[model samples]
Target: MTDGEPIPEERGAPHRGAVWGAAAWSAGVLVLLVALPWAARHRLPDPLATHWGGHDPDGSMSPTGAALFPAGTWLVLVLATAALHRFGRRAATGRARGATGAALAAGGVLLTGAQASIVHANLDHARWQDADPVGTAVAAVVAASALAGLLTWLAARPRGATPAGPRPTPGAPVMAVPPGEQVVWLSRVVNPWLQLTAAVLGVCAMGGLLAPASGLIALNWSLVVPFASTSVIVLACSSVRARVTARGLHLGFGPFGWPARRWSPADLESARAEQRGPAQAGGWGYRINGLGTTVMLRRGTCLVVRNRRGAEFAVSLDDAERGAALLNSLIARSDRTAVTHGDDHR
Candidate 1:
């Protein structure tokens, strides 16, 4: 290949064991979700109470409709999550694969559980006029439990080691600006997509506030705070600067940045350049998927840095290989210094 050609990767096949296991869990929840209403069909009266205002149901629907909504939602979640799991697993590998699949499956299960609890609370042996028992605590408990389970599952799951990835070219570093004369490699990356998305959100919030309907205006007005705030941030701080200085590797907005994330040579174990597609990082922005933490701005070649604690930090930008090589070199130099100092002390 040419001198500047990017390294190719050995993107391995999906983990069928994890895929099937997650699918099975999703399917089980779906079946249970469907079965609850189907078995209780006889007990549920016509025009079942499906909507709740306070502790009691205020609105009603046909038993079949009530049953179908949750059932259908479960079915859709399972199918959609399964597809995401399959595609997500492809980009992820090892423990990330297992963790991602588990996260997806657990998320789907929690949704099903939350919905099931609300639905079950409404189920009773009488005609449809507020006969069912309900409470604020019950709803709160269900939500809290489901959230706890999701977090617990995520925490318990390992971040996993990076799989066998494509290797960087032997001598071709992406951005090896000779630090001999000048002592740093500095670059900037602006996220136009984030700006665009934030703009759209702001416009939607404005439109919602201007909406004729009172409820619509309330919803729109509610959005205005977060949307406008986020828009301002995106416009003002969407750009990130990567600097490799004498100290170590630095990434943030600028000298004093917004994110304020820095990695010292002593803190990191290794760094490597790899091709990071959108799927690999499990979406965009500062995402925390199975791969650990990713500061994704643009998708392409990126630097994956593994810290002493084994967590990975990834950033996608121009001349990623040079940055990675420089960081790795810095880490090696620091290690040698520490070893030499330790022997001298002895």
Candidate 2:
């Protein structure tokens, strides 16, 4: 097996158990949200009214109470977010899972804070009716912080280390490690859940534009629109696959997107591992900053490929040394195979 060549497995469709898991969690969130108003209406009874100002004239809910509602919502969101992280970890690589969880948590906090601020401003100007804006904002912040912390914790869990139903057979070809030639497999680094969430948010933002009172909704749409677009772009790059072969190397981006780019062994320059500090690597994927090209998954090693034209291909692989060895083997095989064919023709 050459280094850049695709490792042969059973040639089955890639496992999508993670997607199913994410879907189940999404359904659970929907069910909970649908039931929340009814379940909490009588029992919780507007924390803002109970703790801050009191009930409104029509008993609808004070401003403070409305603000406090986000706390409860965040609690539910936190649980759902945790579940999403777990599902992502199972479906995606560790770095991707962590990045997705962090992005979701950060995005949620920003959105919640912005909404709370707007509500506070309205209350200050006496433009809106009902509760204590400050109290509500505080409650919302607390809830958002808790949820974010929970997501971070969940994302930090070990990868490919989960206890799935059963393990692969011990001597399976896919499981076997080549002698003296270590292999490094690079999976998609972007989280599908994150991409899906961004798309949903974008759609919601568009929907808000149609509403009569949608000033804030329109603002939200602006924020979410860019995020959705960026996520899609990142997902496209992460899905590209590159494999070393006896004759050459194969490169394809995304699962079903883009044609593969192949390069003959003779066109290759050199393959080596590059190391960088936290500031330079920018936490995984193909990062091209002022420090040059780097593919950082973990902290340590990145596979750097330079072609004859001096173009560089950097991929963040789990095992750097192993991947380097594999590439060397592939190059050697290509040379031998080319020589044998030439001799035979003569």
Candidate 3:
């Protein structure tokens, strides 16, 4: 395949297990949420004290309604998350499917646990009046969500490297590497979860405005703030443009000339094409962890560049081999020019 073209992952893929596991885990959690509350229906108060505030039960819903809300809401969440992921996966060259699955499952667990805790706190007491339903609900959502995120992260462990078709060209310094060449590589990715999250938060934020006193404003704000901030942050990180100039290599978020990473040709250490799967980035696009910064716009071949400090920066682009070739060629040309200038000065 050409270097810039995404490697077709229809072959053996590492994230396959993670994706299937996500499907199973999400469905299982939803099932448990649905079944457990119904089984405990009889034990619950007739009109469950579903909402509590200031150490008093201020709001109540029929026990049947209380049980149904979490089940129904989470069911929709799972479906929406899954469907968005199905399309986003194709659009972005099969990236972040695991993360989308995990997020859906984790969100379901949090909502389910919140309902369960709120209901149980009221039911188990001799006087349902003593239970603080809202407090328990909030705490349960936070704690359970944290645990679910950790579990999802662990579950996403890389199974293996994705095979990128035939053996790649060696990373050795090629004598024919073109130097003084001008080249640009551009790529962009969309994470459906971000837009899905934005929609959910925007809705909740509006709901908060409807009844300012219900504490939903506070509750929804809590969710909206961080999620919105993260979405905006990654928004910049996901869309990228890479260029190899006479000066060096450049990476940036936009066509704007400002705010770009320019690597002086002298600092250029090595460039090679790497084949990776979603497992490598632990989901998708602009993943910056212990592995350094990975601008994964698509799967298959990527151009990874290392500087004098040994730090690696990678971007998934079409014709990665060609990009790497161009980078090395530029480095070679720069060195040759530097040497020629040095001899002339002497």
Question: Which of 1 and 2 is ahead in lDDT?
Answer: 1
Order of the predicted models by TM-score, top scorer first = 1, 3, 2
Cα lDDT of candidate 3 equals: 0.57
By TM-score, how accurate is candidate 3?
A: 0.43
TM-score of each: 0.43, 0.41, 0.43
Predictions in order: lDDT = 0.57, 0.45, 0.57
Ten residues in sequence with the least summed lDDT for candidate 2 = 158-167
Tell me the RMSD of model 3 versus the true structure. 12.0
| lDDT of candidate 1 over 69-159, digit per residue (tens) | 7667767756665565567645454445445544554555454444444445545547667545456534654575466456535432432
Q: Is candidate 1 or candidate 3 better by lDDT?
A: 1
**RMSD value for candidate 1:** 16.9
Q: What stretches of model 3 exceed 4 Å from their correct place? A: 1-25, 28-47, 53-55, 58-67, 81-110, 116-120, 133-182, 186-318
Cα error, residue 73 of model 3, in Å, equals: 1.4
Model 2, 1: alpha-carbon shift in Å? 9.5
Q: Which ten-residue region of model 1 has the weakest summed lDDT?
A: 209-218
* Consecutive 10-residue window with the lowest summed lDDT within model 3: 209-218
Please, what are the lDDT tens digits per residue for candidate 2 over residues 241-298? 4454444545555433345566666766666656655466665455786555654434
Clash totals for all candidate models: 0, 15, 5
